[model samples]
Target: MACLLAVAAGYWVLGRGTPRPTGTWAMGALLGSFAVAFASYAPLVADGLEAIVPHVARLLSNCASLAAATSVLAISFQLNLDPVEARRRIRLRLALFAASAIGMTLLFAYEYMTHRSEQVFALYLLLFVSYLGFAVVDFLLQAVRQSRTTRRSSVRLGLRMAALGCVFALVYVAYKLTHVVSAGLNLHLVPEHSQCTSLVAVPCVFSVTCPALAVLLICLGLTLPAVVYPLSQARRRRWEVASFDALGPLWRDLSNAVPEIVLSPVDSDRGSSADADFMLQRRVIEISDGILALTPYRCRTVQRTAQSLTAADTEEAAAAVEATVVKAALAASKAGQFADEVAPPSAEAASRKDLRGETEWLLLVAAAYARVGDTGQLETVGA
Candidate 1:
């Protein structure tokens, strides 16, 4: 349960921008339920106590639960109630808290006066616990129904998980109700048996088993956003950044060689005013077109040199070789060396399926031009 709370806290920090009323209430419910469940079974760890500690834990748990139910009720109705209605709700919760505090005091007093063992559920179990169970179940069912009717895939999936979590919570509450009735009537649901036969059977229907199972479901439902949302956002950011980095060199050098290839004027301050994705695409297209336009000047010596350098069988190497070949061809065209023009040969594929690959290839092209084509070979390409 502490682990679950930690996860929710992390998620809250990350997702503060888009707060949902339902999600807030669900987090409260998880925490409240965890406290009560943990308190019920704390005896296994410790030997002796005033016995009042568990009662106190149970009381605080009930308070948290009642508050959670109210939140869920508001969430289900989608009612961002006006200030007047909101104040009324707050007053009612305050009244419940006062009553609960008084009730807990009385329980402690009874234990102090009589010095007898106190039943944990003696403090208004049926009234509060049953209401909490129904309220949460109602909210989950509403969410599930709404999700079924909704077209959004992510909402539908998340709601279904919430519904499953609530079902487990319902089972846990059912056990609590059974305990309440049995305790009130002075009867054990797990009836004691007296028999001469040596065989023995044990029944633990009123045990912590149900609540424990419910904890697993609730924690899972609450923590998924913490895991999934951040990773998806991170991936998108990386893709955009990679695209810009890989295409930078080619965009710069090629645009310098043939200014007309760049469709839009550069951003005076940013050096490019286009959106990252659009700019990257434009750069790729413009460079390809310029290379095609210069194809008639392809030199045999330069193509052979490029083929040898690109023999490493990698995209990066191929891109660098291609850059050198293009620079040599552009220089030759400027010198009027190819008196008769021939059609350009079929070019190799970019083979860049993702942003990373695209970025790497483009960056290699830019870096190679900067490294080996610094002789200003394309200075007279248009002359």
Candidate 2:
């Protein structure tokens, strides 16, 4: 659970902006959860010094729980209520959690003085569990209601996971409440020989497993949306950047072959979509112009040979054929073999409806150009 919380904290801190102060509250909850995990487990280490001061450990655990509850309440209020009402309720919840913490501390100290009496410990447990119940229930309700209000799939899914986590937390609270009430009031509310009292079977589930599952689910809820949105944008940006770069060799070769086709200067900064799109658009235009300039050098026989060599009608095969024709055309132009009666070589540009489609088509051609452009195969095939 501590590991999960720590990872969630990193996501909230490093990932693109999270929703306002909820991120702050989430950080607090993560920290408090870490502290609680430490307090609970640190003494179990056989040689640990914390075991010598067990009362201090209990105090730390109590304080950690208080912090976690208060932060969760703050998150719940903001997610479920209007801004003004959220602020008002935040104050109220803070006071409630603080009072509960103080009561638990006093009871803990009293129980320590009484040599850890079961009754006094029961009172402490009851106080903590009551407020914890309230906090978890509120968080559950808020997450469910807020999930319904959002249309974003990520946010809705995250909130539902959080609400499910709260269900586990409520189970822990209810079990603790029952145990404490029976201990403090000397009443047998739970049936005798119940599985809950089984030292081997159910105690670990009620105590450790439930809380751990709840913490895991809540951590996922806190980080999922933060991760999903940025990841999607990054995926798209990476593909566009790769495609833009892939057109480099073809664009450079064409510009060199037809210097007059060059237009405005290229921008060195293509870190953003606007810059990349503009550069891509310019490159497309220049390549088109270069193709037009070489039209007179195009050979109908070379186009037919290139098509026969690449028989498939797939886009890749078409791109290979186009690349072959371009290479042969460039060679003819350089060798002063221009023929005005080639009748456009019978090869036409692939039909595209938009800039993105044009770019994709060109990407296929550019990739094939690197394979067949300077391989001397164009000469053998077009000879």
Candidate 3:
């Protein structure tokens, strides 16, 4: 109970940063239900609370599980997919889960009142196993679907966390099932034996431990972004500044070199066309250098893009130029340097493109360019 309260407090504090209404409400419901369930069992094992406590706890757990399930459904609804369809599915699932929870809660209450040993055990087993299976299946299916569709890194991280939660739930379910089967088998084999108490004790330990561990793990997973988001933003800002700083010296060098290259055209058409190409090349080189100076993370990507261009040009200058443009676009994508000024390849080639090797090369260059840009920015700021 104390551990759960601490987790709840932590979540509340973190929730202050971002208002995730449904998530917060769901967490609160789950914790509240857990507290009630613990209170119900703790008395039976330890200090021995009033007879009513255990019953109340059982009821609370059932209700809380229903509420938590609803919250998950709510999250799916708010995921910005097809809203009408999502809402419809969520409503249907929520209704079914609620009905199951209510029915189980009623059976639990009746069993407690009557003290019918076999029926009570059966009700508990069924409720626990069913909920565990349903939760795991639902969460994994949703996580897999989201992972395939979502482009956002943060969203993908969240989906991974959800998948982990499902796995944990599965482990808990399996542990419970093993205990249930062992106890049932023991009871069947020794109808008059009291040795079946050990089988019951095994399940008791699992019931207590699984919920506690699961709650902690799930809460931690859900709350991670609250801690990580700020750090990620800070890192991005630092990289941006460094990239700009690295570009300075390269830009100056290119500015000085370009006029000389233009004055003495290397080919017959070099005077007009070559000067433009030289300027463009200088800009690209400066950009690449800038990215290199900024962040070590993307340097290899930038280098690879540059290499692809060089190789293509070696084969056929015109073909190389065209390939370079395509490679640059792809490189920018791999580097995540989605600058508006960086044009994509022509639609015709981009659609039917067999540019695997070429694309990889460009991606490397773009990563390097982004790093240089960051380094340049840092230098400029520091200076």
Ranked by TM-score from best down, the candidates are 2, 3, 1
Over 1-383, each residue of candidate 3 has an lDDT whose tens digit, in order, gives 74565467556646456555444554555555545544545535323443435545545554555555455545555564476776787677677777777777777767777874554656666675676577657767877788688776766776677677667667667765664565455444212222224423644434545555555555555555656787776775554344333333434333343343222333331113324434334444444333333332223443344444443333233223333343343345446665444333322323433333333333333333333333222111101
Per-residue lDDT, model 2, residue 273, is: 61
Candidate with more favorable, higher TM-score: 1 or 2: 2
Q: What is the C-alpha lDDT of each candidate?
A: 0.55, 0.72, 0.50
Per-candidate TM equals 0.50, 0.58, 0.54
Whichever of 2 and 3 has more TM-score, that candidate is 2
Model 2 residue runs over 4 Å out of place are: 1-22, 44-56, 78-83, 187-200, 239-383
TM-score for candidate 1, residues paired by index: 0.50
Put down candidate 2 lDDT per residue, 279-378, tens digits, no spaces.
Answer: 7777777877887788887777766777778746777777777777777778888888985556253233547768778788888778777888463244
| Candidate 3 overall lDDT versus native | 0.50
Give residue 202's lDDT in candidate 2 (0 to 100): 65
